[model samples]
Target: MKAAKAPQAPEPTGDPAERLRELKAGLARAAALGGHPPPSLIAVSKTVPAEAIRPLIGAGHRLFGENRVQEAEAKWPPLLAETPGLELHLVGQLQSNKAEAAVRRFDAIHSLDRASLVTALARAIDRTGRHPLLFVQLNLGREPQKGGVAPEGLEDLLKDARNAGLAIFGLMTVPPAAKEPAPYFALLRKLARRHGLAGLSMGMSSDWDIAASLGATHVRIGSALFGPRG
Candidate 1:
């Protein structure tokens, strides 16, 4: 009897390609719906294989959002070295302890929700001389479990961040899973307008079009791009 053939891993197909196509379609739809399309597409590759992402890079998708610092540390350096345009953004709840590593590696950070974390990141910035763009997260959902500065507190945070020399690019937030996220996305946009800020990082795989209509400058999509994380 022939020896059993080694088990083969399934081949990946239309992943990043399909993802880009979907993203473009989404952008078009969003543009047709209301306001201008976002300028940045943050591919939220939380658990997806890095191999799949390179195809996206080849397809002209260079900005990626990693939620965890350790994973980014593991995946970003080589890809960035190989593809110079690659931009790695941090898009999850960040710990103060990780600020040092975060400031050094990420091109932008999307979770500046508290003074303590901001202080930590500022200190890290001073030590590393690396100041990644900052997005002050707002508690749009007002969810008890979520992490963001209460919307009422946004100005003070933005003011301090500006004074510290940290680039206050814009703001971000996660709407409660219970209702439509459009309101929250819109709220962020309105707040950005109020503060005269430039970027708005909202929306995800499911709600980006609404986010775009509401003036999101950056949309972080994961599942739609990677076909649901394993």
Candidate 2:
């Protein structure tokens, strides 16, 4: 007998609001398939300008992800000031020197992958009196060029984060490109379970449904919501 196939998620089409609806429905269906709660969607607004993001914000999308500290600082502050309850997330590599700036601006940091970063964030948190939710990024594919901590070094990083007073809320991973992502998502889920971490920040426009079904708590979506960048 042929095995049952997983449901394919619908492609997000139309305007931003309609796209958001489709994406949310797809995520809900994926969550049902996995027997887990629907994951939070972080509409990745990295290079998209404020004009483009306003519609989603008007449609009640409060969580957004940015790649750089400078860009976020330039774009979000006024928008966030006008729209209360908006949560900005830093979804790219964060330099230790920018820890203070990151702590000040973002609501969650998804790239806490090294000892120096942990120490820097800890000091920044203490100095600013702000505590953003943190995620330990794991280099599941063991890519040298990536920003994630190696699987073998994750425990040590976690230990350092904890000792430095940073509360690690989850694990995040970017699967190797040009390949299937489900296995990586499953591996991340297993790693989180082993470490007693509750959140998994995996998935993107291409494989978010797979990530959701495998137990992702936060899915970072860019093109699906905002269209392709220039």
Candidate 3:
């Protein structure tokens, strides 16, 4: 035999209760490490169907994350009307053209990286007269392909965003995949403190512990919370 081929991965079965419990457990463990609750859990429901989210809604998770503006624009409206206060957030790179639709759709935009995008968002807000929460995405790992302002460039881009009338609430980041996230998480907390921002959206299912302890006001956990999306 081929050495039993390493136990096959579990199937998701599309049950939101299981997802909710998994998230709650991770949060509980993170909370146990300290005297407080994990800040906020933004369930990344990017590929998750709105039907799957019904159970999470039933289970009392009100905030969900979506990657693309068009996808969210298509999915969230009915869910929002049905759930009567559900907040959907745009957690991916947003384009300038989609800014107005995104402003109308999402309660928050987590990946505010570019000054161009910031200017677009401000213009969109002026068009719609709605101010969605914005977080400056800092490319902490400085990955060449990542879509965030360089850490060294954050303040300058933010100054421009403010000058353009964007309501920046805090910062967000994705540290180098594995390899000890604590230091990076701590760095985000330091920046938030220095700027006096009220939100620090860091960490995920894997490293939320480090993030929470370091003062992350929001944690976006996808896999450990919802299992694989595919």
Top-lDDT candidate index: 2
Checking candidate 3 for backbone clashes, the offending pairs are none
Query: Model 1 compared with the native: what TM-score?
Result: 0.89
Report model 2's TM-score to 2 decimal places: 0.95
Report lDDT (Cα) of residue 41, candidate 3. Answer: 81
What lDDT does candidate 1 reach at residue 105?
A: 88
Deviating ranges (above 4 Å) for candidate 2: 1-9
Return the TM-score for each candidate structure: 0.89, 0.95, 0.88
Error of 1 at 178 (Å): 2.1
What is the RMSD, in Å, between candidate 1 and the native fold over all Cα? 9.4
How accurate locally, in lDDT, is each candidate?
0.81, 0.92, 0.79
Query: Where is model 1 poorest over a 10-residue stretch in terms of lDDT?
Result: 3-12
Of models 1 and 2, which has the larger lDDT? 2
Write one digit per residue (lDDT tens) for candidate 1, span 128-174.
98878889988887888988999889988877777766778898988
**Number of clashing pairs, model 2?**
0
Candidate 3: where are CA atoms >4 Å away? 1-15, 32-37
TM-score of 3: 0.88
**52-143 in candidate 2: lDDT tens per residue?**
99999999899999999999999998899899999999999999999999999999999999999999999999999999999999999888
